[model samples]
Target: MQLPIAPEGKVRFVPSIPLALQHAFAMFGSTVLVPLLLGLDPRVALMMGGIGTLIYLISTKFKVPSYLGSSFAFIAPILALKSSLGLGAALAGAVGSGIVYVILALIIQRTGSDWIHKIIPPSFVGAVIVVIGLTLAPSAISLASGGTHFSYNAFWTAMVTLGVAVVVMVWAKGRLGMVPVLVGMIGGYAFAALRGQVNWSIVAKSPWFGLPHFVHPVWNWQAMAILAPVAFVTVAEHLGHLFVAGSITERDFFKDPGLGRSLMGDGIPTILAGLVGAAPTTTYGENLGVLALTRVYSTQVIAEAAVFAILMSFIGKLGGLLQAMPSPVIGGISILLFGVIAASGFRTLVDAKVDFADRRNLVLSSVVLAVGVGNLALPIGRFPVSSLAMATGMGLILNGAFLVYDKIKPEAKDAVEAPQEAAL
Candidate 1:
């Protein structure tokens, strides 16, 4: 692909500061929302997001433009683990997931990204991306449906939230256009408040300043089994995000900081968050959205944003306020957020020029979408894999098989044709 010419020059500190703040604001909603959904401390998520971003920047020598935050891909597994094994065990599973990233980094260091690309191409990556969102579709529906049962009020509020967000994202311009998610959440919250669904007591009773609860992971094999496979999902996500960032910046980051280093940058913080019993972190796409909106690719700007998130984590009231957000409001916002994620995956395929007309591509895409959207599960001995994991595994295998077949078939055909040509 021909790279576009990136605008050259260093970002001035004066403008960098506010741009960083904008980045932070851009990511705040999703970062906090993840922890709040799983009954984890929102403050801890904010703190880890900052710490993780710093870790990513430092690991990459402050060259990569990324901010780490709570991963939505891990949400279903974490929530499931939390329900069955307890939060500590759930976090321990996250640690295992991080270890998977570290392991992939080690492998990349040994063989490089080519080995990965051979087995998993853009179509597979795009399928995994869509699966990640589709796998979470039921959760989004359940959340928007009300606590345990369907509520008309909750459904409408969610619709309102999604509607407002779409409107803002379409009509709003400049930096303002970058915050449709936040605006949508607020709009949903206001609608819920009017319907007397919001509980203000928790926010009122919360302290203004306090330390975020930081606990320790409790090792559990079962939890690890469930959460660890998610690392593959994150792996695909990391590569896709890097590809997007590289396209935007006109720099082949796969060479500069390198994919191995990038994996390490993303992995280390996730391990750190898990060890401290916080939600696992991944590079924030919302912040990436901010990067696209602003066209500022400076790592310094993202670093500043990380710093702000770290500082904000100490504010107990802010965390409390996030937790106090009405369920319906959260549900409403979730519908849009999760749906956008799935859509982004589809867009990635389109951007990658994946040819669906090819039989192999069609089969792979169809199978992945069906399995993922349907949330089908297959048991491997005593262990069961989620739809996303199964889809990723299937995509890797199918892509690799087809790639090998494509390579070998031409050689076989040439060998047969050479004999015919000699006869002629």
Candidate 2:
């Protein structure tokens, strides 16, 4: 008998149930991760993430299965907003993030990729990412040190699991490597279990399926303003993800699927999430990396993962298991992912061929990096502020300012003469 034909280069007939389950699991793992870190309901992120993915599929014509959900980058901003205001207010800011992306999509429809370069330069975007990652360093440390939902015993368990996960991730080949985060999590949980660090009562007392924490929107002026800057950074991130997916599919998505549509896709869900008290929405880069690794591009696979995530939201035990994961393990993974994200900025700079010696580039890069990492801030009227979100906002504005100024000014006479002399 002839072998079953491979459903190569096609998206139909493959989004089956089993594949769907696997996809759901993966999606659940990735999206639930964000809320877990931020002390929000992981279940909320999962359901929203699944819903967001469905929206994205519809927007992108069900071609791209890339799951959208809680963005790790949005964590610091959300946390800062919560501390400054409250949860409802912080979520309101998340809704703003979707609006920001929709606006960018409109810009893209008008100006295309060139518009991206206008607002989001290598220096600016890089600085924003750096701020996003490094700003969370404190939380990583505190959590690893048993600050939240973890004990000293749990810390060691987490550390061991994290260490093994790191090793597996760094050393493991192929499919194993693709799931380092999950591996580290499971490994950590196993150790925590052995050490009796996990409280089974939390797991046993909860129902198998129940309604998750579904938050509703309430206006908060302070939080809205505080979290507004995340729009800039996460918007840039949105463009980056679309570009990546386009590159992967070898199709100009901006042409057919339409960037505006995709943003609308991501935006609608993000808005839904914000209104429903879910975390921020985003396309997970790591999951894309996994797709690349697994050679699995089936949107059905992602759909499966999304369903699993949706189902898991109702399971207290599953949520508890995620909670049972140690802080140090997350800390370890964050360190790697954070550095990689920062390095992505460096790569962007290199690709753009921005001159370090050029005064314009130097000023832009120096100011952006310094202000970003150094936590520089600009006070607007009465609010007291200094944070990753503010730093990123300041850096982006400055970077754009430098770009404009450099473009407007002519070369100095001395520099012009010096170039002529060299030519001579």
TM-score for each predicted model, relative to the true structure: 0.88, 0.86
lDDT of 1 by residue, 1-424 (tens): 1222132336778867888899998988888878878888888888989989888888777777888889988887687667666889889989999988999898988887887775666677778778777777677788788868789988888888878888988999988788888888888888888988778888887889889888888988877777777787788778888887887777788987899999999998999999875788888788778778777777877878889999999888887777878777777778778888889889989988987755566778887788777777676554556667667667767776776776878665344334433746
**Which residues of candidate 2, in runs, are more than 4 Å off?**
1-22, 25-27, 110-113, 148-155, 324-329, 351-353, 377-386, 406-424
Compute the lDDT of residue 421 as modeled in candidate 2: 38
Per-candidate RMSD, Å = 4.7, 3.9
What would the per-residue lDDT of candidate 2 be over residues 1-424, giving only the tens digit for each residue? 1222111234444445544554454445457667777777787788788878877887777776477868877777677666666677778878877777777677766766566666676656665676666666666666666775656764575577668767976899865666666777777777767776676776777667788778876786666666666777776777777777666656566666777777778877887889988887888776666565555566666766676677767887777666655566666555555656677777767766765655545666676667667766454454434566666666677766655665777564236334333756
TM-score of 1: 0.88
Give the lowest summed-lDDT range of ten residues in model 2: 1-10
